[model samples]
Target: MPQSSNVPNGASAAPKAKYNRPKPVVLAVIDGWGVAPHWGGNAVTLAKIPFMNKAMQEFPHTTLQASGEGVGLPPNERGNSEVGHLNIGAGQVVLQYFPSITKAIQDKTFFSNEVILQGINQAKQNGKRVHIIGLVSPGGIHSHIEHLYALLEVAKQQQFTDVCIHAITDGRDTPPFVSQEFLADVTTKTQELGVGSICTVSGRYYSMDRDHRWERVEKSYRAMVEGVGPTAATPEAAVAAAYRDGFSDEFIPPTVIQGPKNTFKPIMDGDTVIFFNFRGDRAREITQALMKPNFEGFDRKKSVSNLYFVGFTYYEEGLPIHVAFRPHNVKKSLSGVISDAGMRQLHVAESEKYAHVTYFFNGGNEQPVKGEDRIVIPSPHVPSFDQVPEMSTVQIADTVIQNINRYDFIVLNFACPDMVGHTGNLRAAIQSCEAVDANLNKIAQAVAQAGGIFAITADHGNVEQMVNPKTGEPDTEHTNNPVPFIVTGNAVVNCQLRSGGILSDVAPTLLHILNIPKPAEMTGSSLLVVQPQVARSAASTL
Candidate 1:
């Protein structure tokens, strides 16, 4: 018989449910959780996981502010993955290396500046080739093409020789399948300078995600250059503004840019890798595959335990629990006998309602940012009557309920809070939060074995605080949420868990708990060493 969180379980593990605590492997991965570790992002979402809840109780617990305090970005800075992971694993605050380099050159200080740039210039000085590779689009979601140009301009001025720039084609962060025109723009600019600047652009394939195509990106650029009306590129302009101010182009006519990919072909060696993407999910599956892949690629250099996975903006959300009971009423009796605290609401759905749930479009907006947001949209509008979420969840619920403890590490991301905030839709954010809360309670109760330790924290903060749209000032956004880090298992008894911490501390802290060595590069200190006081009242509440 299967049991669910909505219905309590009896005194012990299920008849055949096996709770084997898996090996203590380090699960040091970055998530797109800008909302907060404990409340809005994956941190909170993961908290509701019963298995995690029960596990952490036994382990020690603590909290760290990952984004601002731990990572060392500006206090008010948004949590981007690059800094997040670097601080998480690197053990030190490495400023935006590229931008800092540019500033150094502009101020005539490149010759004597920060160690990071000194390192880049040192690579050049040592006759070690410098390979600057990043996304091709000017969109700031990832690396900006203009930033590459800016870097090139500075490099030439500083007379650092033998610099190669390879632009990776991107559509995932910008349009569906965007044109490589920016590639052309960048190369043309490189050649126009004739300062011995070389460029190459790369991509796995060229096609729009679904129906959107490269042509659309090209057309949008054309419109921008021609000073025509706005299209997909309009709202994107704001993002560009956010990252790089003073980039006021009067929409010059499209310049037919061209280039040769061979000039920039990545050699297996000959140069140190400098990946630059300050504001987007820079590396996805490719980063891991390239670093520690079980497979191989053409002319790819594998990492020697020097693998670095970096990025920006991070990620999930769920709906109300609409479940189906497998084996019909046979589990009904089991359901009644096992409910622990009699704390939840459960009912046998009408036979008609018991049918397998079918998932459909909930009219969820996948990519919610606009081109150039002159006026930040507010989230006051109600979901139209027509909008409906998909339904396959019930099937998933059944399977998870029946077989609770199968995998060692389960990483789930809850995103509705972020989504709701992006729309400036506070109500939706609340609904999303409640939905998350419901889902979490069920999960926590389900997986929380008597001796398990669960850690809950956020990647960043989005839904917690709302910045003013018209004024761009800070406002209370969804309670400016602060997430919880809770451990329910035996490990907690000896664990000195407390509060008043940030984000980057989470990874290293977790790593410390797992007994994994924090690489000298990680900037965060382990929470295990610090005495974390249990907060009588949390920083933020829904």
Candidate 2:
């Protein structure tokens, strides 16, 4: 809410006034594109990305560290879109939710969290069940298996015996067929701790749909609350049945696991539900279905009264739920600074990554600022992105091109490379990259014609490394690789880009190009190498 145009950070002091600052600066985030070491499974290297390759050579370009500490994740942790966009918008390293939760657990703070304790105590006092729901994976993109384990430990310590885990299998951030292994691990941990049971199993496709897919949300919701899905004798049996039905971990239909005496455990009245996903984008829709009394997404067969809801982190602003770990406040974001300057901006992306452009890119702020425009192209409703490697890039590019000259700043995300790269199909990944490159060329040309500056970068790495070097198998996980940052246009014709920059520097760099002083809260320095005389002469022309 703080919107002062005063520049407080000396790190972002105004450059010399002589640069030809272009209007309508465009920041195109080529999701999942990275600079790889070798061509081994590297889609960016094998793909026909002529524009990106030529721009890197011809323009002021640099490789930015996108993973681990650079984006404020744990050491060596592969960066995800959430943290990547947050850092890019904030113009500073924003500590992510994963590390904060991990630290809480390590220091015994998690067990004593007031919100978590309240949920457990409510369940115990009411003599009702406590339900833990989240994506069951070690990938750490959205939810981590370790965090689930820690929640179970909390249940045990609190003497809440009746507990159920609604496991949501993941294949995008993890291997396609590793759900059985993760379920087995969860079972062992629960047995050892003498707490909780895996009562229901589903895939992220059903449980974590953020694209307003009401049917998918209804499927997962009904399976947990109404017990309206297939039944299996055990959690392992449920996952095995899904595999036998030719379903991968991500598309596994919701199945209710049988409890004692051949009974199913559906969420009932007076139940306390704790959603354990640390990240919020995918978790928002499902949380709304469970907690919102006036929920209109899908008709629930029956409403469970007196249901208590809790979330690992705040899913959105003004959501009626308790948060075990609140989000960190990110002040003076790139969008905030631009809005304060009374500049018009546009944020565009497909449904697959709409949140990245607007929500995460605004430093966790959900609402749009003054003069901010948002356009979301509907993504394909296919089972796998590999099937449609060009996921809405053409439409997004069309939108950007049509509105190129209307806004002072434009931000768009091309989600093809990242979404398709998760399918572990190198050929499809290459095709996705090419599709993005083709469309990106069109936008770049439009921006050039408008006499505007455009910067091409990425949130993280996925399509770049498709195969695991050690086992030579398909690797669907995000890589801890650096992404390329290329600036193009007449404004920065002879400018030198600083080396050793990270995603956090992008915002400041854009501000510097616009001749705007970076906010005090922005710790990152501009990536533009400034020359006083040249900058001065350029500004005089403008």
Candidate 3:
């Protein structure tokens, strides 16, 4: 890639510092690792993580608030990879789309949104059916049951009798068997509102695939628009039968529901669709299958004309779809600042989490900045991550180590712990922790050899707590926990890290060590506790 002198719009000039340091800074984000007080169900405590354990004792470390308001999510909401990476790179609290959509509903602005109204009114005027689709869970990680209800309410208010919901069950973000309760809740709410019926059902594994799994996405598309799947009497029956057939909520095969007149209601030519998912990553592939005119992912089998598709938020740039709420603008990101300073940066991760290290970590910029290099390792194509517990961590570590001397800053993510942790298998989660630890030790040694600084932290908590304390059941959901931040290597000999910090502080601290000035747009301060003598000396020299 050719380097350019043009800087991003919001990027500011990073003035050269008086205190010069030649060694690079490496940030390793150990996803799904968190600190907990209990021993039971705590995989991090149960597993052997020699590198992490020693770093905590030998380095300047502190616990950071990664969940809820600290990461700009709704109060009490658990932190997710999306918001976690955004906060870590933006150096400020980047408000998430969930709270904005919730507030829109609360203030009665949701119903009047132009894109939503256009889809609903067009369907109503054409005497065509309106279809709402999304994950039917209260997990708040991707889609919420409440957001689905709000869209259903729009149908009720518009008096569109021909309304249907395409439900996608979630097991990774919620309890494995809790889909029944969520489907029941949606059924009751639609009944109370006197509108809409569940017309199709599928698991998120088929509908929410982000790994270019065309087969899985095609299954969901055919079920929703072509009615090419097993028939069920009702949504409840579909989930019950799946459970009986030894299929968990996440792996339920796509099934079409039979209507009152003993017929299936496939989406028609003039029908409209509204996907009510707030997050974008898992929703992008399915959205493309539904809305893209020239989609070549798989054969559609049947194509509907004049179908107006609306997404809850922007899935990708330049897609032929309308968005209900646009993303919050994030400027002067850490990557942008580094680029403006003419530093070489490398972002490496497996396909499972490649977007986190680049897109989300760069403040939603899909294109890389000048002097930025990205490497994406292919993840395994297993049915579940537990089958391949490591999931390419060794490859990622090798890539990072090989390029440590070439880049001024390197950002890497290990997807094993978080991806396997979602399976609710304690043994697999433990193995993942061990895998990450072993490779992490290698990367740290290589960084030390390069005479650079090594920083370690996590996005949120998952592998830490495997089982629910109340019911003693396997819990796959993220916890409202704080993650650890540890800094080791030559740059910080006697430096003291601040006691309390959040994910946003990570970027500022890196800039501080690099001797780069933080942009004015960054609200986060450095977590490095500068001694009085050193501070005064630096100030006098400046």
lDDT winner among the candidates?
A: 2
Of the two candidates 1 and 2, the one with more favorable TM-score, higher being better, is 2
TM-score of each: 0.42, 0.94, 0.94
Compose the digit string of candidate 1's lDDT tens values, residues 368-484: 111100001111222320121111223323333333443222223343444344334344444544554454445545555523334444444555543444554433222223334
Rank candidates, lDDT, best first: 2, 3, 1
Count clashes in each candidate, considering only residues at least 3 apart in sequence or on different chains: 87, 8, 0
Candidate 1 Cα outliers beyond 4 Å, as residue runs: 1-63, 72-75, 81-404, 467-484, 493-496, 515-523, 529-542
Question: Residue by residue across 1-542, what tens digits does model 3's lDDT show?
Answer: 21112333323234342345446789999889989986789988888899988988888899999989889889999999999999999999999988888888999999888998899999888888888899999888998888888888877788776788899999988889989899889888878988878989999999999989899999999998888888888888899999999989999999998957224678888789899998888999988887778989998888777788889998887678888898888889999998888787788889888889988999999888777878888888898999999999999999889888877889999999899999999999999999999999999999899888899999999999999999999888898889989888755755789977999999999998778889998899889896887565544322
Tell me how far the alpha carbon of residue 395 in candidate 3 is from the true structure, in angstroms, after superposition: 0.5
Which regions of candidate 2 fall more than 4 Å away from where they truly are?
Answer: 1-20, 259-263
RMSD of 2: 5.2
State each model's C-alpha RMSD to the native.
17.0, 5.2, 3.8
